[model samples]
Target: MGGFATGLARVTTATILASSALPWPQPWHSAGNAQARGSGRPITSGPNFFTAEEFAMVRQLCERIYPQDEEGPGADGLGVPLFIDGQLSTPYGYGARWYMHGPFVAGPPEAGYQLPYAPRQLYRLALERLNAFCLENWQKPFVQLSEEVQVDLLTWLEKDALSLGPVPGNVFFELLRANTLEGVFSDPIHGGNHLMKSWYLTGFPGARADFMDWINQEGAAYPFGPVSIPVLPHKRDEQG
Candidate 1:
């Protein structure tokens, strides 16, 4: 549960640019010239409990995962943390889609998440448990711990060596980490893939009408690798 699934591992140079088997929704347009809906959105920055805490935690964690560098846009630039928050605010995060009905037993490895807890519960317990462990081991809460301590804490949780709770620490880490990558790469319509840094990393072209004219051209490097600018509502029919 902590590591990758068998046969699921495919390390490639391009994650976003690679041909995906994921059934992502089709690209949609942003509302016209409207300012970003900074309001009316449930913040997912920290834990789902308090708005300020969630925001701080997510922002900090995201920056750690994708630090600003000469490479490209960072996680914050891509708005990954915000996307994570948005996702959690939905039924998906609350475990509405999960099989919470009990007679719950620890089943075989293949059974997967047989327990009744959802993301919110799992995180709530995990956070509290991790904080407690931190108080004993490092004398600080998970968020307050220094960067080095954070790594140590993360490592322990990822390894499932942290005896915080039965929340499946390793499984939780992998889930959160994978989703974090999604937020880093998925279409912005889904609210992650902000500046499209993941696309740049993997050399994938995005939603464009055609590559026919450039296909036959040889030798010369294509003028553009494969860029996908936002296709807002006004640009929708332009494809046809």
Candidate 2:
């Protein structure tokens, strides 16, 4: 992951530098501010994976994971749910990239994912069972629960104390947590981070061409605002 992170930074630097050399439309941005001009645009696509009820649940879950505070926008507002949905519609969601065939061993914690369900299936089953459990206990769906109750339920999920049908609660919680972070921080071109709000919050120069000169400045605030990979329809499809 560290290697990947370093590589991504390098790629970002190269791409941004090359793009800057070309005549391209650059979205105006400012440094040290969480908000960027023309960023944080509203997500336009409808859910391709989750139904309305489930999508609502996902939205709530994601926002709860990274709620709106004095810092900046929360997950749903940043399209984290939509990002997960978009991811589910791709090969990644189907687990096409993984070696699904198994000797089926759960030897230790060090061993990786041994679940039978694909990522898409896990989401569907988890949401359905969670809603059922919530209704049984609280007379409502998880999405309809109050924020306090929702937080309690999420805690139970984190502790693996909740049973949601065939899907392990802890596994679901882990997946949701990971996906939430990915959606919040990943490039907006991948259907999350809606306008690079998180980048701005973290002082990440998203796609800004040249920051080589500023690399030596430690503990100093970035002067140029973050940039992003401009979304082109074909590129989106290709990446997904």
Candidate 3:
């Protein structure tokens, strides 16, 4: 993931400016300086785990990470932010499945997930710190920054070039970027990849048993189109 940082930096130019169908900028100021609370607030009355401000940030961040292109619709169009919000609303956000013992050591990269904060805590704290940094340095909130400035700030986060107060910038970047990809490529039932646009873009014959015939055709396009599941959420127990 760290090695991919350079590639990420290279690709965010269009991403920073791409807001094909985002639903954030309008609602951001509508809340009128409302700070985020742990109490789950629906983003636009949808099933959400984020406050209005957090949802705004998440939506903007996802769009910047995977903006629309000639290839297809961006994260904003696919509602990747909503997907992330839904995931965070579940037990996964609380890190329920992780071992939360002490004796914590900041060991090597192989040590794996040494942070004390859960996924939910990480996003909340990181966003707070990030907004603070933006206000102090740029005299505005992150969501209000210019497209070029947004790209620069995100690049700084990716490169660990900025001090995000107590929240590690690189860690936050990794989490945000990873979730963006997951929302783009995961099954639509999870609330992203709307219509399986990514599958069509990647030529991935999703869940199709008959795709075996096309395996040998390297250069030829698949004759069949991509298939997607319904918009409903998959059962967590079934996933487990």
- After superposition, the stretches of candidate 3 with alpha carbons farther than 4 Å from their true spots are 1-6, 9-47, 212-220, 230-240
lDDT of 2 by residue, 1-240 (tens): 123222332334334333232222222133423454324334866788899999999999887777765546678778899899989988999999888886766556688788788899999999999999988998988878888778777778889999787777988998998898788788777778876776655656677777778776755555565677775766655544
TM-score for each of the candidates: 0.68, 0.79, 0.75
- Each candidate's lDDT (Cα)? 0.57, 0.73, 0.66
- The better-scoring model by TM-score among 1 and 2 is 2
Cα lDDT tens digits for candidate 3, 105-167: 777868888888888899998888888888988899889987667777788888888756666
Q: Which window of ten consecutive residues has the lowest lDDT sum in model 3? A: 33-42
Stretches of candidate 2 above 4 Å error?
1-42, 103-105, 217-220, 236-240
Poorly placed runs, candidate 1 (over 4 Å): 1-50, 214-222, 225-240
Pairs in clash, predicted candidate 3: none
Error of 1 at 79 (Å): 1.4
Clashes of each: 6, 3, 0
Cα lDDT of candidate 3 equals 0.66
